[model samples]
Target chain A: MKKINYNRELCDFCGTCVSVCPQDAIELSENNLEITDKCTVCMNCVYICPLRALEVKNEG
Target chain B: MKDRYDVIVVGGGPSGSMAAMFAARAGVSVLMLEKDREIGLPVRCAEGVGDKGLRSVVDINPNWIAQKITTVKLISPAGMEVVIGTDEVGYILNRKMFDPGLAELAAQAGSEIITKAYVNGLLLDNNKVTGVRVRTLGREFQVKASIVIGADGVESRVGRWAGIKTWEKLNDMETCAQVTAQNINVQQDAIHLYFSNTRAPKGYLWVFPKGNGLANVGIGISGEASRHKSPFAYLFEFLQTNFPQAAIITTVAGGVPCAREPEKIVANGLMLVGDAARQVNPVSGGGIVTGMIAGKIAGQVAGQAIIDGKTDEKRLAEYARLWQKAEGKKHKVFYKLKEFVYNMSDKDLDDTAKIALQIPQDKRTILQLFKTALVQKPALILEAIKVLT
Candidate 1:
């Protein structure tokens, strides 16, 4: 399945993903960020991230 | 974590600390939670604040200020410069210390503070915010409180959970990128702002000096404008074109809400402050002072309401009413001004710059510039009268 994946090394935790999340799936505190189950793989976060920290990849 | 408290403040920024400080000072038990390992690590803001407005809320600490500025320069799209000598002073803060200083005041006021405490969810009782479900170091706790203050920054889950509609529309959201750079070739006495739709649509590029050969250079573009090309692209171009030799030390990107219409800041047993409430100035996209102001008012109201044993929506409306009168009403006028000024074409801006140049340097104020340049609209003149005076 094609699933959304997050790369912690690149994430800035600036909450740009939270700002654009249609499902409110992204929860971002100051130092940490989590993508909740409410995510529908809409790809808004992937496209808007300035660092390209989030991506879509095949997962088993 | 305790079983219950009078007020629980989420986040430990200016707004959160201000709220916690005033609430605790009013003879209530307050808890201020910060998710980060330290209170002021990983600075996110442009670190700009007005001296006069900042003093109204907290004491001035010279140790926290990087630079104190008195003059500003505005660059037109056509490269015309309008140098403005402001009556009020501005400060570029070192938020690594400034934020924690505010939290220190909150602690001194008797608010219990906990860092490395992440609030995952809200604890609700009958659809009203009763507490927070926070996680700390692989352990979870249901910390209860009579009122929860959401100073949780731009994308606030606390405000959203309280049914406060804290989302920002595209027009009001600013996607920003900033870098602390060294060896920038510019005067350090004045803040420089450049405006152009092609460069920064519906926003401006800024260079705030930090005194010792370092500067904070940044750009903000509307969320809608950034959809095609990210702010990173614009900043990269800006650095290449302006200060190609400057070395970058730190870079950050974030979303700042500059909403023309603020959300309902108060709900049953819960209050929102700072960026969470969209209390930011619409024109400048500055929120620190306004957030501090909102936090003070919310804390006082939350304290009084809790002391009276009533923490319902009806009782909490005082915060909304007071905030509207305090800063929200003026923000409405500012948003109108932003719409008027930024919507002007490059030709119009160039024309305004020409007009502004005719005035003596000592006589040029922001109000005078608006009065002369905004001669195109009669309705706007009426608004100008209400605002400038």
Candidate 2:
């Protein structure tokens, strides 16, 4: 499975990813941005992050 | 602090503040929660509102006005430019100041606001919302309220938490990027909008001047079209061609819910306002005014419902009914118009630009273009007349 990873340094936390996420997995706030269990590694957030703060991590 | 109130508003944007302010004025105890530490920072909008749209809701404060606009410059991909002059006033607002100003009004109306007080989820009782679960730096607790107004904007979770279908499909979502830049050359008193496919597929690029060579330059591409190409790419291309010498100051990206306002914005004891309900103008992707309008109606209805001890979906439907009667129906006309306009090919747009030039200068208004576009649909033209005029 491929899981999504986020880098806090690069994130703007603008909630762009939350709107485009088809699975409704991303939760954003003033200080924290969490990708919950509902995320299916859809990569919508990864592709759409304007700051490139998110990526996909492979699992074995 | 007390854990109970008559109403709780989530998010502190134009809609939330309007909801909170009006509800509090109705003599109900209202609590407004803001996820941001500040009332207005990290602006996610182009911040332009029509003169009439602003005045119809509230009186204008000079401090919030960044610039007064007198003309609109519409440009085509082929370099065709049509300048339409307007007598009615328009403004490019300083939203960093404007949003908080509205929140101040809410506070003056006796709405208790807590910044950085994030409402993480809804507190439902037997399928009816009774309150909200909030987390602040000080502590976390559940606060009870008769109604919750979700004015949480495009990334709204409150509506979803309340079990209303709130997701905007990719086709209806306008993925966007914007920058406040300096040392750019453009008309100071006019807003510039560029239409193209390669530059902004199924969307448009805008330059709103804020005087002294500073402007908010932005672009929006349909989420479906932006699946492969990001809005950043399109925005960079536009800046490269138009303002290569410009120095970028701030960059922000987001989505505009360019979909139809949900048929159901009210669930049991819950009402969604603003972008949460997708009350944005489908054609322009602007909601600052429409959101406030819906917010006022939502707050009024919610206050009355709570005072009458009936806050269920049946009673809350009055908000939706009044909003739909006021602007939601017109939004439908604009949505249909959006489908027709956004689906046009690059060539179709350029041709339309050429055809637009054929009309006399003073007569070439946005309404004229809309009438021409919907010529095949006379019924739609009739509705547009009711909306535009």
Candidate 3:
């Protein structure tokens, strides 16, 4: 399984992750951005984050 | 908060702000919403705008300009360089200040401006967009409007929510990454563009000088190439090789729609502008000017629609007609040029660079380069002349 980790402090909520996500897994609320379970570890959000707030880890 | 407005513009970038300003200037009640708490934080663009385009839309404000550009250098894959002098000059903007400044202009023009107001979806009445449902500061609200303008950018949900078919193919999306770095050596008055398949892969890299050893260095890669490697990785490598000692000040990454405007941009009671409408220049990947132009048109038409009490697709079609006449025709040609240039092999690019170098440095112009690049398509010569001259 692949899991995603988010650093809330680093996130500026620019919503680039939500924009690039192929799985429609990210959403931005007023203060925080949520990555849903549908995130397929595609790593698009991880690479696109200007603040480097997202990380994807492979858990075997 | 007022639940109704004559015009509701979603997004506070140049397009949204301009739309709000023009709409409000016409005595219409306008409200502009920005998703971010700050207008232009986490800036995603290289921030370069041509002088003519900027002057056409807004007054030249010294506070908004970071550097004045007088020249552009095109470097080929094989390291050949062709430098072209700009006729009207350009500017690398301080977007952090520029975006807010435009928002302030909108506010001053009698438009209500709100930050941290993230538009979540569209409010539709009988398959026509009538308003937007926005979430702000942990509270959600629905604001009704006679007209809705979606200037929300490339990942525009407002357009999608309205069923406008805003989907873009992978090839049309350019994944981009940029950093403002200090202590980098750059020509103070020139923007350097590097074209190479190995470096950018179906797109190009840019070093836009922001004066005094500061520059916005960035790379844009086609979505097809981005699927194989991250744009950030390429940018990192480029920086390590070029400006190893430079300190990174700010980093940004996003996608630019390098495609023609969507076939349909206006729906009943709603319209799309800027990146939401995919109005970016296909070759340069710049949208600020075009967005503002579209914003002005949309705003004017929107205000007129409100005045006439008719906000249907037919009335708003004036915006589409006007924008297509203004720059849409040129953009269509640029799209074809982008497809042609991006598809060129490294050898072809190298050959083109060699040809460009043959022109006298003093005589070298952007139009001449375009002429060389489009030599195979002799049919486009007249169109190139129309664009350049």
Candidate 4:
């Protein structure tokens, strides 16, 4: 499965990723960005992140 | 920690703040939770509002005014320009100050305001919202409320958590990119709008001047059309062509819901306002005024429901009824108009502009321009009359 990784240092918690995610997978809480199991790895957030804080990874 | 309140308003944008303010003014204990440490930072909006649309709701604070605009210029694909001048004015806002200022007003009206409070989910009892579960500063806690008002923006989780279908079609979503640029030569008092399939693709590009050689340059492309090219790329190309010497100050990318309001804005013990409710104007993709209007109505109804001791869907349905009567009906018409406009070819748009320009400049109005565009649809003439008048 392809997974997502978020760089906390680069994220400003803009919530743009949360809005673009069709599956409701990404969340921005106080601690950090959390990707849930519902993620289809469609990479919507990866492209939408203004700061380039999100990256996609394949973890088989 | 205290965990209960009469009303809990989620998100601290214009809608949430207005909801909180009105609810608190109604003599109810209201709590407003904002996820960001500061309200309105990382501004996402182009921040233009018509004078009538804004002043009808709240007093215009001078501090929030970035620029006062009196003219609007529409540029067609073939470089045809049609300028409309009117006594009716518009203002571009400094959202960084405008948002927090509205929140401050809510606080002054007696709503308890808390920043850095991110709502993780709802606390439900028997499928009815009882409160919200929040995470703040690495701590998790639950706060109970009689009514949960979801004024959260387009990315609203509160509505979905409450089981309302808040989905939008790809064609109805506008992928947007904006930048505040310095040293751009723009008409100081005129806002420019550019329309073309190649330039914007089912959307439009805008240049709103903020005075002193600064302007907000932005583009909004329909999400379906954006598949071939990102909104950022479209905007970058436009900027390079028009304002090559402009220095970019900040860049922002986001999505705007350009669809009809969801059928259901209220559920058991819950109500949605603002972008969560999809109250934005489909044609303009502008929501500040509409959201605040929805917020006002939602707050009033929620406050009344609290006092009446009935927080179910039946009582909460008044919010939807009132909003539909107020703006939802018009928004529905605008949605249809948006579809009609988006379907137009570049040549069609150029022809429409040429036809509109045939009319004398002094006699020209936005209504006349729309009439030219929709001249083929006689039925829409009546609908446009109702909407424009």
Best by DockQ: 2
Computed on C-alpha atoms, the DockQ of candidate 4 is 0.33
Pick the winner on lDDT between candidates 2 and 3. 2
Q: What CAPRI-style quality would you assign to candidate 4?
A: acceptable
| Model 4 residue pairs with clashes | none
RMSD to native for every prediction? 2.6, 2.8, 3.6, 3.0
Best by TM-score: 2
Question: Fnat per model, in the order given?
Answer: 0.39, 0.47, 0.09, 0.18
Residue A5 displacement (Å), model 1: 4.6
Native-to-model Cα distance after best TM-score fit, residue B246 in candidate 1, in Å: 0.9
lDDT of 2 by residue, B1-389 (tens): 47999999999999999999999988899999999999988799998999898887788999998888988988888889977656777899999999999999999999999988888899999999999999897789899999999999888989889877787667788888999999878889889999887888888999999888889999988877777788888899889988999899989888888997776999999999999899998878999999999999998898888889999999999999999898988898888778766766677667667777888878988877766555534545555554555
lDDT (0-100) at residue B90 of candidate 4?
95
Error of 2 at A15 (Å): 1.0
Report the Cα lDDT for residue B174, model 3: 84
TM-score on B-chain, cand. 4: 0.95
Least well predicted 10-residue stretch by lDDT in candidate 1 chain B? B376-385
Worst 10 residues of 2 chain B by lDDT: B375-384
lDDT of 2 at B195: 87
Best-fitting candidate, scored by lDDT: 2
The best-first sequence of candidates by DockQ reads 2, 1, 4, 3
Per-residue alpha-carbon lDDT of candidate 3 for residues B124-156, written as tens digits (9 for 90 to 100) = 999888899998878999999999999988777
lDDT of 2: 0.86
iRMS of each prediction in angstroms? 2.0, 1.8, 3.6, 3.2
Of models 1 and 4, which has the larger TM-score? 1
TM-score for each prediction? 0.93, 0.94, 0.90, 0.92
CAPRI category for model 2? medium
